[model samples]
Structure formats: structure tokens, C-alpha cells
Target: MKNQEVADLLREIAEYLEITDVPFKPRAYQRAALVIETLAEPIEDIWKAGKLEDIPSVGEGIAKKIAEYLEKGKSAYLKKLKKELPIDADALLSVGGLGPKKVKILYKTLNIKNIEDLKKAAEQKKIRNIEGFGEKTENTILEGITFLQKTENRISLGFALPLAESLKDQLLASKRVHTAEIAGSLRRSKETIGDIDLLAASDNPKRAVEAFLTIAAPKALLGKGEKKCSVILTSGMQVDLRIVKREEFGAALQYFTGSKSHNIALRNKAIKKGYKLNEYGLFKRNKRIAGGTEDSIYKKLGMAFIPPEMRENLGEIQLAEKGSIPPLVKLKDIKGDFHTHTIYSDGRASIEEMIKKAESLGYSFIGISDHFGHLRIANAMDEQRIKKQWKEINAVQKKHPKIKIVKGAEVNINKDGSLDIPPAVLRSLDYAIISVHTNFKMGKQEMTKRICDAMEHENILVLGHPTGGMIGERKPYEVDFDEVVLAAKQHNIALEINSQSKRMDLASPLAKAAIEQGCRVSINTDAHYPDSLEFMRFGVGIARRAWAGKADIINAKELKQKS
Candidate 1:
């Protein structure tokens, strides 16, 4: 979908508007950009339906700009704004904490136009002398720059997966294309993708390649041949497309959808069996066999089919050979989400709206776990507000009796192993998720004790975003996860796998450790908006990577009332 493309343009416009001292227009554009990002359908589809103005927070002006972008693949006003500013505004804003205001200040004060310039300034200690930036801010900028350098080429799975799916859909539309599938790290469901790899089966390779090239609209055609083509998209993602005959499709898919180690292990197994395995087919004594399907190929090698996510060569092959691979959790296995927020706290959607969205997704129950009083910045619910929220939830329960709505709060864990909310208030709710939102710099022993104490609270049900990492932007806070897992097991508190794209905390490895340590895991979106609920798939992917089964996840079962 062109949703991300349009959102990027709108955000760029917002940044430029902020630099130009425009009143309120920048915020309007920013809000519109956020709304566009969360939209399920393509922005072009909305424009085609003549209902761009129907989108929330998008008015006439932004609608016109979006229409221009969809029709021409560029916005004239955005171009004009870029030309006027004449700086690498996007590059400057790529730093974690560097907002448009900071970008403007850097540009005006030190003539910093890009990351290189900013890095040089920070290294020279010039930024600390600026009006608002001090030594601490300078050090943070340097750290952000380092982080940006490390992750600049790596795109998150959440962003790359949709783009790859769209490309596959476009390729499948062609009459010449028989079947198309994404391969490489994408198929393996890696957290970050380096590039997109696609494979298609077709009778006419040339025709399929032509159709792919036309749809891709490459900024630069890297190469082209009768059976293979490589191109760089305008969005700077490289895609490699290859077309093979139907007979070779499965072999080709298995060969390409690989971790190097997995393929090598499979090849060794094939060699021991006096067979040769490659992209074309598996061969014994130069006679082709077992290339028509992945299942057939695995059967010929005397092993069960290994799921792509488990093909990380992390003992999966041995398990497959032994026929003991456990069933990984699937999206359909989840009965409901135990961790979610609403308009009562930091969430954008109201309680009714969240419940309705969950019902639409076939969930039988959902918990409204909003922020508690400690997260003052989120405008958290106090005693009175909590009572009002429960009253509203009761009203909704009467109206929507088919789905269960559990009232809960995401109570903050204080530094000295105490919960931010009173025990009485916590006990009054259905359950509570005790989380650490601040004081991330606490020492390992202190942090472990704090989390363990929170887990001891009778009202605490789950530990939310266990590690408090923001992917590439921020490092996970220091804590002895082994001790934390032991405590969770002892206290019967579930550790959460937060599915927000930015913070997939309690990441796959940690989740796997918790499961192995006999602590049940909760896979939650920690969704603040209705659209964010869809992020559950990413969480499921992490769980699969962790080799977590349905029974290992708490939310996979029907909701039961706490004693």
C-alpha cells in the first residue's frame, strides 16, 4: 500500500512546516500522518473512492496533498517546502531524540545539514555550548548517531513484510505468473530484513520478468535476464525476483528461503543419502526426484518438514529428524489480549471502540489494562477515574454480552519494589500488569528485586514489556532475566512479549528462556490504538521463533477469573 509513502511525505511536510514557524499546521500534518500510518487500506484506494476527507484528522488541505502524491507519486507543496529549507531535514530527524525543532536549532546554530555534520559537531563538543543542548544531550546525540549507523540499512519486519506482500500481490495479478512467494529472512520471519527476495513459478520466464519490472518501477535496474531480475525500489529497498518452472518451484523455494546453516545441514543430509540437492531439484545417480514439493523433499531426506521460522539451524534439524518438534503458537490460537489500553489512559480509542475492534478480530475476551496513577505523563486513571471507567465497562458488558471485558490496570513498579497504585485499588480490579516505565538505569540487583517484589503482589497478573527495549532506538535495561524468570515462576506471574513494532520487548530469546524456566508467557500488542491490535502477528512470530507452543502462552486459553 502507498499508505507509508504518503505518510512519509506528510511527515516531511510537517517537519518543514515546523521549521517555517507555521502555527498548528505542523501538528495537523503530524496527526494526519499518524492516522495514515495506521490505516488498513491504501491511501490511493481512499482517494479513488473520493473519500479522503472522510479520514479522521485529515482535512481538505492534507487530502489535496495526499491526492497529489497518489496521482503523481510526488507532492508539489512538499517539493517546494524541501527546496525552501535546502537541508537534509529527514536525515537530521532520523536520530532518536532529534525532533524537527532540534533539527532547526542545529541547522541555524552550527549549520548542521546532515548526520555527518551533526556527528562532527557533537564530537568537537560544539553542541554542548548551544542554548538548550548540554553535555548530556550531546552525548545522547552521539549515541543516537551510533545507533542510526548500526541500523540504517536494516528495516523492521513490520515495515518490510507489508511491502513484500504488496509486491507479491502485484506479481500474482499477472496472467503469466503462476505462484509467487517471498523468501530469505522474510520467510524466516526475522525481526529485521536486509532486502526482499521473491520467487515465482511460470511457464514463460520472460513474460513474468517483464510483468515484475513494470510493477516494481525500479529507481535503478540492477540487472535483468530471462529468468532473473534485480531492482532497487524508489523507497530504497532492493528486491530480487526470479522465475522458475513449476517442477523446480519447491526446490527453488526451499533453497532460497534459507539460513545458510540450515541449507548446509540439509545438503549434508542429502549427501549422506547419496543424493544431491540444489535449486533445480534433488538428484540420485543424476536422476531428478523429490523436487515437486517441500514435503516430498523432506520425506526423501528422512525428516519432517521444518517450519521456516524454526530453520535458524538452532537444533531444529535434529528435532525434525527425531520427529519431536513441538507445535508453535499460531495467531488463531489466541483467545483474547490481556494487555491493552483505552482513551481512559494513553490509548487513542475509547473502551467501546477497542472492544468492537477485538470482536471483529474474533476475540472472545479482552482486558482493558490502562496506565495507573504513577504514569502521570499518560494522564493515568486515579481512584475516581478508575471507578468511572469500570462503570462504563459494565455498561458496555450489558450491551455486548457475547464478549467478556476484563477491567485491569498497568500499575507501575516503583524503585523500591512497591507498586505505584495501592494494593486495595489493584485488588479491586480483575487483574493488573506491573511494569517498569522509568528508572531504567537502576542496577541489576535493584531492578531484579523491584520486579520480583512486584511479581509477589497478589493482584499482579503479568509483567509488561519485560526488558523495556525499543528495538534499535534504545538498549534493554540491565536486569538478571534468569532471576526475574525464577521469580515469575515462583509467583505465577506471566512475563509479557510486548508486540509493539518499536518495542518487541521480552524478545524471542528471553521469551523462550521464560517458557523453559516454567513461567507462562503472555503475547500482547500493548496496543494503544485500534489498528495497533493487528501487531499481534509480529508477537506471534517472536513466539514461534522462541519455539513457544500454544499452551505456553496465557492468552491462548479462555479467560478465567482470578481467585
Candidate 2:
């Protein structure tokens, strides 16, 4: 929550600066915002350690603003911006095609202050009549509104997971919780989550519940009970906390950390063995048999313990019964990350900082796959710049002897289905990732063929964000997964499970399907900054849910040996 609070303020500052015609300052705030949003550690902790300036792109000024906000409950600069602009920059900026300039035009010309106002303007054809906005742009705004509306009530996993974990830590810190675990879809690592569920076993349930309410400082209380409580957080996210005895903790967790169907199947299996399964315990005719642990219950029921992410009742139960559950890819199993960006592109951090961070993580290698070719919006590098970067990388590699820094580029696949980089240039690099940067409106056949045609290039190592789905925002471009997966297999290109919170592309099911078809997939953070390197957890989680073992992940082994 603290991280997001800071990130939002940074983003708002960026939007306001851009709206006011300030140059360079807007991108600075934007870069800082990206870093904070993707950080694995809590922002408050960094501030408490007096190391805010150490964060990527956070200069002394930005650090002061962050520290000021952390100390006080608000940002004075943001407050001043709001007073001057009086515009809902956050809401307006959320619309896909609307930038700060467009937002300013809408606000000044049409009195459109927020998403609702913009929607009304678009619907009434008022925006199209305005200069610069034609029918196409206005129509796109309406579509963005519709897309934004669909994501109401649910929050992205990127935001939800950290919030849940932080709350759980607070509970433990209160010295009231004996054991606590997050449950529900949040535990399952779903791309987007509705409500957060946390279960705990406490010696003093009343005291534990009281401490939780105080730490959470909920916006509103929904209900109250002896050991259970529900409240709305400041972010308007619903969180539920339940306390149980230590013996029943595992049982309660197993019951509540379910996908309904998985639980139902478990009960049915227990019934066949003349046992009862419930939140309390698995019981015989008169005595308790298993309840002390989740594994105990599964073991008693004659099945292997299923991982929480795989408890979706999608053939997992059958596999568990057969003791054939595959060992899913773990975060620790990853040896290197291939799809990272640095300052040579639009990334916030420099190449040296990225390498140092990777080294700190004990990574054996890190790929500097900055944006390349004609994607000008990304500040892509040309051939000369690529050559320059390689020299810098070569120099940096000498200093970091333990880690192999590979020079790579995230090349764009043009409309005509050819890579933007020349063949000669592509042959000189460690690797290249082909992605669709424009023309998302292409039909499925055209889009699939375009990507597949690009896949034929021998220089390509991976298909970056195969589906290009942005969670709760832009839908994936039209493309048949089977054909794309087939092309990837034929071309020996690994599909990337991009781990950006907003773009957990290669959705778990599709990733699983690709693996089932004997195609290897790479789990990458697609990190734009050093801190975002932590987002690798999201990709690993998705891969786990996809039932991918370490062997199924490209980065989990020696890179050259995989292909």
C-alpha cells in the first residue's frame, strides 16, 4: 500500500508536469514511479533506512518528496498540483490513448475532468468535433472506458499480493498471531483478485483481531465476530481476517484457501473412505483423524499434497491421486532473466546498476535486452547505439566477473512481418526477442501469420509476451494460440511468460497448453528497472500454475543447453 501510494503520487506528478508543458521533468517522475511500483521491498522500509535516494531514478529532490510523504501522510507537491490543475489526471491518464496533452485539451476544451466526463464527451460526439480528435480517437476513448469499467472491484495481483503480505506481517508483528497465511485467489496468484483473505491461528483471538483492525486502519468495518473480521481498506479493497486454534489452523487454511471445486472433490474423496472432511478436520465415526496439517489431510485421503496454485480442480486432483504431480518451477530455480531493459532504451536504470542488482540476487547471468529498432516511443537504439552499448557492456562485464552480461535487444516485428533490425546486425548479438509493438487491431489470421513469419528468423530466441494481454486493461491482440505455439515449436523459439504486473502475458492456461504441446517457455520479468527484477516472482507463480517444471522453463537451466 505504501509503495502504491508513492507510485501514484509520482505518476500524478508526471501527468501534471506533462499537462503543464514541462519538459523532461515528467519522464523523470514517470521513471521513478515505475521503479517504486515494481519494488519487492516496502517503500517505507527504504525511507526508514534513509536510502530513498538509492532507489533507481530517485534523485535528492524526488527522495525528499518521498521522505516528506512518508513522514507526513500526504505529498505537498501533489496537493499543490491538484489545487492548480483541479483535474483528475490519474483517471484521465488511465485511458489508453489519452496522454497528458490530450487530457489537457479535453479538460480545457470540453470541461472533461474525469473518466465519466470523457465518456460522456465521447458518447455525445463532442470530443470528435474538437481539434486533433477525430472519430477514431474518440471511439477509442469509449472503448477504454468500457475496458476500465470491466476491472471495477478487482485489483491487480501486483497490487494485491504485496498488500496482503504486508498486512500479514503486521499481524505477526503484533505478537498476537501464532501463524498466519493468505488465502483465496490471492494465494492462488490469480492475475487479478477480488477480495483478500487471511487466516491465522492465535492464542488470543480477540487481541489478534483487535490488533489487525488497528494496523489495517480500515476505511469501514463490514462485520465483527469473536475471531473473524471483515473491513474495507483505505484503497477500497475488501480484506477478511479469521483466527483459529493452532491445531485447526491448517484445516481452516486448506478449507478457505480453496477454489470451491477442489474442496468439493476432496470431500467426495474423503467420503468414499468413510471419513468426513471440513474446516475443522478429517474425522472418523467418532474421533479426529487428520486436521493438524494440510499435507496430513491429503496424505490421509491417499493423495499427494497439491500446491495452492494448482488447487483449481483442473485435473490436478486426479494427478495428485496418481502421485504424478509435476514439480512446478520455483523462483529460486531461475538462473537468469532474459527480457530486461536499461537506460539505453526507456528503462529507468543504467546498465551497470541493473547488472549490480542482478549480481546481488546471485544471478549467474542477466540479459540487457533493451528496446531496439524503430520503436521511437521506447527510445529504441539504432545500429550505432547498439554498437556503443555493446562496448559499454563489454567494459562492465570485466568489473562483474561472476555474472555473464549478455547483449540482447527487444526487436520489433514490423507490419510487413520482418524484424526492424538488419540481418547483419541481428547476427552479432547474443539473442533477440521479437514483439508486436503496433497494429494490435490486426485480425487473428493476419496477426498470427505476421508473428509466425517473423518467427522463421533464425536469429530470434524468444517470442516476447506472446499474447500481449495487459491485465484488467488492454485485451490480448487477436491471435490463435495453437498456431503461435506451433510456430514457436517449429522455429525453436521459447514463448516468454512476461512478469510485469500489468502484463502477465502468456496467461497461465495458455502457458500450460504450450508446455503440454512440448514447447518450452521462458519466464521473464520484462523488467524496465532494477527493482522490477523482483517481478520475476509473478512469472514464476504463473508458470507454477501452468504446471511447468524447472526443465520446462528456458532460464531455469544453462541457456545454451535448453535449445
Candidate 3:
């Protein structure tokens, strides 16, 4: 899954092009980046198959660049762009509202080349005096810089997961490694991670370490040993790989993939059962009893195997002991995703492309839930546009008969407990997902009432990203979620487990609480593009971590037509 690595390079190139005022190529590179990141298979594998141009939005020109990246792990065009700009694009982009254009202006006008310069300019009121930047924008830049400072060490799971999996896959392919899996917080599917931990088993530890170094192509080596190695990835993520014997593999993986508290609980349980537990194996009077497999160790402990995500010492042990750990929802349980966007609104892809991607995912149905009404900034559809989209959907359905293309709209919950989309227009929609797009500073009572009011409307299937939390960007808005959950249960509105990486709102704990209150949830990618539909597994991960079952998820069943 060099997919992420290549996508990042393409995005970097796009940023450079945008800064240099290169027309059209920037958008092409941006689109290609999205497609690559969302690819189902590894980009390296795709290049190996000699079908680079077969990728959507990848023309002959982009294909050559991708091939270059695949072969040399560097793009000549990207290198040229970097030589031209010589600026840290990612640092400036991290500011809330700054884009490449603004970055260019800052660099050209004020010689603000990095976050430090930008921060100083904002603090000294120099940015506000600039032509394009205002006082408010200056204040926002300061706030964003503060946020970045607080979270500079934390890496979003969205980036870490794919990059870690790519490294894991590479290790396995080397043949020196018998098995390899990413461990640590990444394995638990936390929204943000610090670093990556990989555990593996191999007959030849020295060969495995050498293979990892070759595959990583690290920017710098932190440590290297026969059985243990550490390096810094190009993405600035630190990866530590450890190799062990085949017999100790499971225990080693479990040991490394720990929440710390879970291992403590397990060790206590092992002691009570007259067993000594460590990375080697579960031992009974110094005689190794179980270690070959994770399931074997769990079975020896008189408990069911706990999922890595649920190993947070969050009441999982009791269920494992009862041998009735609820059957957590999986990605395979998803029948369809009801929340998606297209060119009708702010989405990157068109309606047909979205439908085709859904079909490729073998979805029974896919909802085109574009922004509607007060979301004018997103180019949201009005009555006429909604009807036109319905017609277009009707026509597109003819070409794709295997999956049902349900027409839906995402509406904003007004502060006065009303919906932006008129009820008359909503009736024509197969479903409506309501969200908090504005007025996020409302008090808890007001926010809860607003969300509950909208859920009372018919065909309102989901409360989209109920918490409105964006990882490292925005905190969840103040809302009485308990009250909201009660209302959802009363009205049968499903809580959404939005899996947008940065916005996995109605986070695991909230989803768990909703499920415990007998309110169903719908795990959706909230995909803005066909490639991002790949985020469904991350949503499912949240559900599983919350101990949700297929029955607890609404889209696990067939979708019925609205009208």
C-alpha cells in the first residue's frame, strides 16, 4: 500500500504547483492523489501489474510520475517542484484556513517560509496588515498554530494506519519474515497515534531486519540490531520493528499490541489460574502451556479471544470470561453506506463515479446524500437542484442495475430546532442525515434540542457525526448526548459512526453509549470521493471497539425506499 506514500508525494507536488501558479496540473495531481490513497490494492502492486493508466484520473503523464515514484521512491517532477519552492508546505497547510495561495502570498509578501515565521507574523500583527489576511484570519492562524503546537507529536490514524500496513505488507513479501503485523495504538485503531510498532516472527532475524530496512528506505536510522530495528519514515513517523521466534510470535504480538492495562489484567488472571504469563508464553510451574497462537493463550486462560481493538481493559475481560463477548460488527456486515457526497455538492467525484465505486465495493445500495439547503458554501442543492439530481439518479440507475442508488440529502440542524431543508423537499429523499455545520458554540441544552428536533422529521435516518469532533482540529460541540440518545431511540434515528479519519465522530465511547441505550447506529465513510469509500473499515473499527454487533448497526440490513 505504497498508496499513501505515492498519494502524499502527489499532494506535495500539487501544493508546489499551486504555489508556483501552475494551472490545471495541480488539480490533476490532487485528484490522482485521492484516487491512489483510496485504491483497494497496493499502488506498488498496481504498478507491477503495468496498469497505472487504468487508475481513474491517472493519464499518461501522471502514470509516468507514479511509475517513477514506484521505482526510485522519488519523483523527479516533485523534486523539481521542491527545488523551486524550498518551503515546508505541510506546516503552513496545517493552519486552519491557509491554502497554497495564501502560503505563496505569505512567502512572497512577508517571507513567511514556515510555521514559525507565520506564527511570529500573526503574533506581531504583521499578517493582519498584509493585503489578503485580515485581523480575524490572523487570530485564526494563531489559534491554529497553538493547536498544532499541542498536537505536533500526535499523528492521525488515517495516515499512520495505511503507512504502517504498507510496511507490514512489505515485510511479509520479503519472504524472510513468516508473519508481520502492526501493533501498539495503531492496532487498537485510536484516532491519533504517536508512532508505529510492528511485531514479526522469522527463522532468520538478521535477514528480516535487513529486509525491513530495504523496504522502509528510511530517511534516517535511529537504531538497528539483529532482532530489533528502528527508523524514521519519510512521513516523519517513527517505526520500530521487532522479530521473534515462531513459537513466541503470538505472545510477542499480544505483548506489543497492548493497552498496558489490558496486559496487567491478563497477567493477574493468569496468576489466579496458576499460570505465569509473559511474551514467551503462558507457563504453569515453568512448563510452557500456551503460546503458539493468541487463541490458544486465551483458551488456556478459560476465556474467549479478545479483539485487539477491545483490549483496552474496557469491560472486555468479563465478557471473555462468560464466553459471550458480543459478536462485534465487522466491515463485511455492512450492506451499504447511506452517507456520501458527489459533484452535486462539495464532493470530489460525480454521481455515476460514486455509484460505480459503491458497486465495486459490492454494496447492495449507496446513498447520494449531497448537501442540501442552507449549506450554500458547499454548493448545496435547492428544490430545483434536488429534483434535477433525482432525475439524474433515475437515469443513472438504468446503467447500473446491480445496486440501488438511493437519493438523500445532508441537512443542517438549525439553532432554532429546525432543519435547513424544507420538509416538503425531504419527502422526496430516500433518507436525510442531519449535521451541525455551523453555530457549533451553542450551549449543551440548545445543541441537544436542536439535534432532537430534526430527528423528529420523517425519513431522517441518521444523526451525522453527532459530536462534530474533528481530530486535532475541532473538539466536539457541547451537547447532552444522553438526551440526544434518548430522543434517537424514541424516534428510531440511527447515530452515525462517521469514518472520515479526521472526523470519526460519535466516537467509540459515544457509539457504545448509544448502543447500550438501545439506539442503533450506522457506520458510514461519509465519503466525499469514491476512493474515500475505503474508510468504511475505520468506521467498523469504531463499532467493534464499542462492542457493537451487526444488529446494532442500521445499514447492516437492507435499505427500504423512502418514497
Q: Pick the candidate with the highest lDDT.
A: 2
Q: Residue-wise lDDT of candidate 3 within 81-106, one digit each (tens)?
A: 77788789877887776988899999
| Residue pairs whose backbone atoms clash in candidate 3 | none
Off by over 4 Å in 2: none
Q: What digit string (tens of lDDT, one per residue) describes model 1 on residues 284-388?
A: 988888887787899888898888888888899999999888899999998889888888997778899899989998999999999988587777889999999
Instruction: Give the Cα lDDT of each candidate.
Output: 0.87, 0.89, 0.87
Q: Between prediction 2 and prediction 3, which has the larger TM-score?
A: 2
| Tens-digit lDDT track of model 2 for 395-464 | 9999998899988999999887899998998999999999998988788999989999999987788899
Off by over 4 Å in 1: 19-21, 374-377, 415-417, 441-446, 561-563
TM-score of 2: 0.95
- Indicate the residue-level lDDT of 521 in model 3: 91
State candidate 1's TM-score: 0.94
Candidate 3, residue 4: Cα displacement in angstroms equals 1.8
Write down the TM-score of every candidate. Answer: 0.94, 0.95, 0.90
Pairs of residues at least 3 apart in sequence or in different chains that clash in candidate 1:
none
Instruction: Report the C-alpha displacement of residue 438, candidate 3, in angstroms.
Output: 3.8
- Candidate 3 stretches with Cα past 4 Å from truth are 19-25, 48-50, 75-86, 100-105, 108-110, 124-136, 348-353, 374-377, 398-402, 414-417, 439-450, 472-474, 560-563
Each model's total of backbone clashes = 0, 0, 0
